[model samples]
Target chain A: MARPVHSFVCEIGRVCSKAELKASEQPSALWVGVKAQKLPDLCLACLQAGGVFDSAFTYPSSISSHWAAVYVFCVPKLSKPVVLFSHAKQFHSVSAQIPAAVWDERKMREISGADFIGLNDLRPIIIHPESAKFVTNPLRGAHAPGRRPSARERSAGHEEPAGHGSEYGFAGTGEEGEFQIPVGPVHAGIIEPGHFRFHVGGEPIHKLEVRLSFLHRGIEDFACGRPMDGVLPLIEQVSADESVANGVAYAQAVESLASIEVPRKAESLRLILLELERIYSHLADLGGMAMDVGYYASSSRFATLRENMMRLNGRVGGSRFLRGLVVVGGMARDMPEDSLRQIRTSLRLFSDSLAKTEDLTLSSSTFIDRAFSTGRVSPEVARRLSLVGPVARASGVPCDARKHFAYGAYRSNAVRESLGQGGDVFSRFMVKLGEVKESVRLIEHQLAQDIDGPVLSERRDLSKLPSGRMALGWTEAPRGSCMFLVRSANKGALGRLAIRTASWRNWIGIQEAVRGNITADFPLINKSFNLSYAGADL
Target chain B: MHEFDALLSPKTDRIYADSPDPAIRELALFLKSRPLSPFSRSIAVRMVDCGSSNDVELEEGLTNAPQVDCERFGIHFVASPRHADVLIASGPVSVNMKLALEKTYRAMSRPKAVVAAGDGACTGGLLAGAHGVYKSGRVEEVIPVDVKVAGNPPAPYELVLGMLKAGQILSKKRI
Candidate 1:
């Protein structure tokens, strides 16, 4: 099975002159380097040959000029990813052929100073336009730390910037009475900050533009010089709820780069922790959706269940958010056997309570009325945008990373992907609910295995390992698929750490889902998607 | 029918822990004892997310959850800064959000108290000295902080305790 995929990648390498297949430790991955000029065409050819566009990022080049770019594609029937690498400072934009590459190329153009010809929408996404003077490109190696604003600039900023819509060229139908409504960077509710602009005529929306990165903390730049083992806490902060998934993803990238095999017991414990994270994370989404529709009883019940899950997490892993459990090689320490037993026992009660909550929510006419056809994302748009996790699954696109790129315990225990037919708010709700139940099943299966071995691998320190090795780690987070691209630098420090979360991929889907939705239903629609601003901004 | 039947059986999952932190209760009593304290009974709080990882916001929302339920102790999260008497700001104030955070602070009326919630808002946490944020990433650097709740992201009980402390300070300011 792996033989054909290697030749297929080799065939791709043959299409462009002076192509070389880079040696890799993982047999599942095929890394090929081609001429920089041939990148756009080669990317199109890969897309044409049934490969799904996964992620693209640029890093500072060691051997050549300023920048080197890597484009990742996930081919069907192959467990690992196939990556195309090129070292260049300039290239034709592949966004012309693959729409998913647009944001990636624009980001590369801004941060790494790479020139992508024919790229549209070159406005700064991460750095605010007003502060562009002080911080030009933080990702550039020689770029200085941004200076504090002067007193004059501080006084100038006292006045609120007028019409946030004008900065993003607020798109709308120019017909009479079609006015613009701008909301946030600071929202009404207790949620992460991101700006939303709605172009509306009366109640119905003409268009919606979501401008994010208000939470961009330069996480990639922060990770630049840090040792591989020390960055788990930083990765865990990517999104609090998805901490374990992100940590595991970063860990897998480092472990695979160093070619370390995690022990059996560690793998089992990791699976339990990962599934518990998914259950708790999805519970919030389920509860929030109910709360938005004014189903307070059901919402409170779901919150109660989520609180129980978090307490269970604290009891088992010692952190409510389940941080500090997953490290570079394997588990940080062994989970108490009694606590594992306690989880297995309490899950039955949890399952029963959830069933009742689901019954109360689904049976409510008010919930059905608000959610049934509201905030619809067609399967076509989901495919075009490369939406992942539950949002893509709700749209009937089977794109679960757990199923496609199985890692650790997921390799032995096949996950049953819960899919929905309608891409509306109700479908997303149903899909998430289904996933919570499946997570319980997955956890039960892991505990039943009774595997025992050393939780942490002996070869923990990667500082002694050679550098310049790069690998991709992916996990099926509750929101969707999260991919972390890690490159080992000199003395095991991180050369580059590029993250693409499920929230980042699915935030674009919200813009598509809210096309014709009424202004009133926007919150309900938005809550259903529950995209994370921190994940997207980073 | 299942919903109706379940109602008759009445399975209550209500958490019976320390409903209000003992510190919060003691503070509430102390505030009630003072005649000059305007916010002894209730205080409206508006949360400003200055670029947190969303953990602080999650913990803030959970303050309203049944297990923690800070509302019974006179904490209300308002929709507008104008309605709020207390401002709870979180995150390592990012450069992009510096203007917005400052504007939000300005929007609140005088006699308003600000509580910097979470490690990020208090000391910039993990992102301190990172390029994307303003100096040290503390909310105090951008605005006056009357109270500081410190944790990776403070738990709900800790957040409520911090807000109560802010209320206690707000009363002194009023006098």
Candidate 2:
């Protein structure tokens, strides 16, 4: 199903011309398409293409149709972009192609009445067996399901299928002694809930399957009738860390579809906010990587740095994580002169501290020992899976949405991506750290060049938006290039909003990276990827 | 090392030098007054996570997920709902996690205290009443919450607040 064949000119990557590699996408071999019946073929193409089998989710409401399965792909470059899309109706499943899609398909099928015709694993993903009657896709609004639930059925995420599979086996090649250790739908950590089953022999895991959906908040359905502007706050709720990214994506989608343009100053200010986000996010991950390696000093020091960044966030954007600052056309309020000065001061502070922190972490033998060789992802694998951001750069895949797809003020600047070769945890850490420095550089550059004028653009009233157009907006967010597709309805309100994050595409590749690694190293490895549960679940 | 340690040891750990917050000192004294258990494990409850903001990490220790010193002080994090006598719920309780939270609570044999951790879980700090939320802002909206550890994200000590409150409730029940 994977499509191939695309030739591009150097310098600027404009698709010179495209030949279909297989079927259905501009870059054919890169993204494969299949009819619902060709689910197994889809899986074979993905496995054959050597990309990571990322995730499968159901929109529950598909463009006025009550249900649909939105299967996502994170393949490397053949022709298609990193994310692949396919639409399927209710009672039909596509898990036959990719084994990891099983749990997601089961949940989608149970809740939204979708199907997985050839699914080997179809146990209820989350909802209890007794709660199976509800056909409630809380995330989507008014999109009528093929069937409705009985009075006994309750709403929300709980809608487990009755009497399902009693046993499931890991697809292992050899090893008679290999066994599976199931971790959680509920775990000991202060994090999101996911069911992790690790098939292992001794310490090495042969196979791993992650069953996620513990954080699905039914956001899509909730935002259905809400005004176009009303969606930003709700989108921010979908993932807290990605407030800037998601907000920008939503705004971009709205702007593109509506054809709205803002002042130059607002654009640069938006870039500043975006860079602040990247720094804090990368710092958190760096600290996490240190913590995973048992480097308490490095971890604590980095945490202090991260905390300072958060404080800077509060000072600049009003809220700590830059929430409420982002609106549809432009930002809510312009940055106070004092706030800009404060930001400049903090940038210097961050730069000074980062250098010292780097010395501490880099010089620490233990920290390097822990991160240097853990969870090594190869370049070929990175391309196949279509991994993004630091993960892709680590494997020498130089595809950064920031540099590739120019948006905000970034179209004018020199944005250099921090890349690595080994694709290990250290590489991921280096990329994130280097990106943080680059963010500082961005903030400094923007500050040096004054941005004067109104933050918001002069546009039609949000309530009175124009109709019948679609726009795609993206920003190089903290995690990666977050994309948003916004389609307008009859009125100014958005008819359809498809939001995808780096975490969603990267998570599957993480499961692949875990192959052959020790179970104990999973935490360090997972930290390196640092994918978002809220982003993926959405 | 000895000289610096000795210099800091006497006045440094003499109750006042241990913490910056008076609340922490108060809590320390409270702990000192109790019969402390003794035991420790090499592996703490270490976790690598993908969801939520870094609020969880903020509420816990930065070095490890959270070195709760549970077994070291009559405290223990349960492996199973049956094993866990306490239910520590985090975040604003999105609709997806509500069932898992409820199921985890139900599976515990008996005598469970649900500690709502993080600002979002406690009072839905910022993202309240929005689309992504399950219902109301708090986790209690989805389940019966016993204690709330509130902050933008409750500091580790603040996290201890809920568990300690639960401990108080547990001891009272036992008595």
Candidate 3:
């Protein structure tokens, strides 16, 4: 389904629904309110409307102000799209309406000392259980005995968590039919480390609980007041494969805060690299999925093709994953014509090889047998958890942040989304494959195009003191849309910056997908969904 | 012919015409530059899993999985680190894992080499200064390292290259 011409009509509809909520004149900013009472009611209406729930975070809107829990919303058809919720200013907890908002709410309450009532399962998702309790952001006049918060605080914080004061222990009755098989926070693969506790009877899995945070870099706390340029390298580490996407999201957030515009050429170059990044990332997942399902010929071919593309990328971009290529306001360098032509040729070869891989995979009966019904995520669950990207698309939820949100010249159609039906492993596979083709097509169209402009934008001179400010930037990364909220206290660099990658939001979907699946099919199911450990751990 | 044109001869076929793989071609050239050894039987290397980092553990687990029919790939992971030809370690050299790494290295026969498999192992790149992590964040700091495979966690292909590099190092070592 496509947006009807003159889609401003939907904007009008949103304004009518939330009369108190107003649309700002800024490029794309939506303003809404809690009406002092109906926080739950407003959240419920927003959740049911099928909007992409971006992230939930806490910022003291004003430096001296108490912590305000914020929920970021990406409403595709709304005039005033961004919706925020805070339990401190309004309710205790804002997660009653959103199932995926649990981790964010718990994290907010832990650090800022906010309270979130009515939130379910508020565990310390990032900090270790035994860490001591020191302020997460000592920059807000809070103090860390050391330069960084001590582990004593973080360890105890993990056990109690910010929001969850009470959590029940998990133990099952000893019976002949049940046995527990624990598989790591340190997994066996290229996969990110996250502990999985499974209750199984014979070969069938009855229950599974995931424990992540093995690679926690404390990106949010560490990012406070770091120079803008210094931030990209840190942001890029969120997910190695989706670095550019995180770069774009962070850069855009800072640009919007300062009201700076990225030059057209810079924008075009950004899209080109973003699409290239999308292709390689998806190829890794596609090949991994095929191999997971026992189609080695198809999987190995995919790997061979993937390696070739990565080498080609390293030649053109300097770094294979396109790191150090992006900066605030624009790209670090321009794409030469020879490199563009080489990329075009590389794409064609990749497309051709992809066909052979597809044929081999499609013909292999054993491959299809494992993937078809394995890790089937119900359409209802997709909606309930607000699934995104292929996970959302496969489950018959047609949401693409790039297409709908329209940022970074992606609206030009150089890159379109690969979508899928209600959430299943096959749906995720089809969505990734669709995206690969779009990436090739997008890069091809941009080959001869020229943008008349500068590559870099001027920076903000933050020497003067004033009231702290808040700004948000997001990009539709290959994994899904990643959002960043940067808030600078007049005293220094932004006191608090929250970076939420798509992996954090989609982790619950993985748990849901494995519910009915057999224990033997875990790897196949995990590969298909392919959520990130580093991204989620942050 | 121009230098660039001369570079095209090795990958003259139109098959991969878009761009030639200089890496593979260079790898081939590097091999060709050396004289062939009478040692037809390649080194049999075994990766050890001492409950180390994710990628190392995964590659270690993959040792028993049916090997891809690709040749010149004789890397096996031994159940006991004592039987391992190569102690492929990945970690920030954690205190708990330190004894294990040393035990595994000591267990390996002489002329054995150690390949540190990821940035965490090579430089303790990310996990520096953490409570659980040791003060110094390098595998070499704890143990004498032969080859370092650097990456957040090196990709599987890179891991293969690092091991092969260790194999080359192993060939030169005197028993």
Candidate 1 falls in which docking quality class?
acceptable
lDDT of each: 0.81, 0.63, 0.63
State the DockQ, from 0 to 1, for candidate 3: 0.13
lDDT of 2 by residue, A1-538 (tens): 3223333111111112122113333211133333444444444555555444444444443346445344444344432233333455534454444444555566556556554565556555543333323224433333432233433543543343445333333355367998878887666655556667888998998888776655655455546556787778778866667788789878876875566786788788888888888888788789888887888777766776766676568667777678888887888888888999988876775677778879988998888787887898999778666577788898888877677656778778769888999899989998898899988898899999997998888883655665544455666667776666565665567666666678766776787888889999998998888877767666
lDDT of 2 at B128: 54
Q: Model 3: per-residue lDDT, tens digit, B1-175?
A: 3212222121221212232644344334534453433221244454432222343543333322222221344454444545545667776654434444565577678777788877777777654444334445577866788988777545444565566567667767788
Q: How much is A371 displaced in model 3, in angstroms?
A: 1.3
Q: Which has the greatest DockQ?
A: 1
On lDDT, who's better, 1 or 2? 1
| Candidate 1 lDDT by residue in tens digits, A103-144 | 877677666545677886666677777655434345343432
Candidate 3 lDDT, A309-424, residue by residue in tens = 66677789887677788987787877777887888777776777677677777787887777787788877887778777777877777667777777877767634556666466
Candidate 1 has which clashing residue pairs, if any?
A389-A480
Question: Model 1, B56-165: lDDT tens per residue?
Answer: 89888888877668787789999999998899999898888888988998998878899999899998899887778877899998899999988887777778878988
Worst-scoring 10-residue span by lDDT in model 2 chain A: A8-17
Candidate 1: residue A381 Cα off by (Å): 0.9
How high is each candidate's TM-score? 0.92, 0.75, 0.79
> How is the predicted docking of candidate 2 categorized under the CAPRI scheme?
incorrect
Residue B55 lDDT, candidate 2, scale 0-100: 52
Better lDDT candidate (2, 3): 3
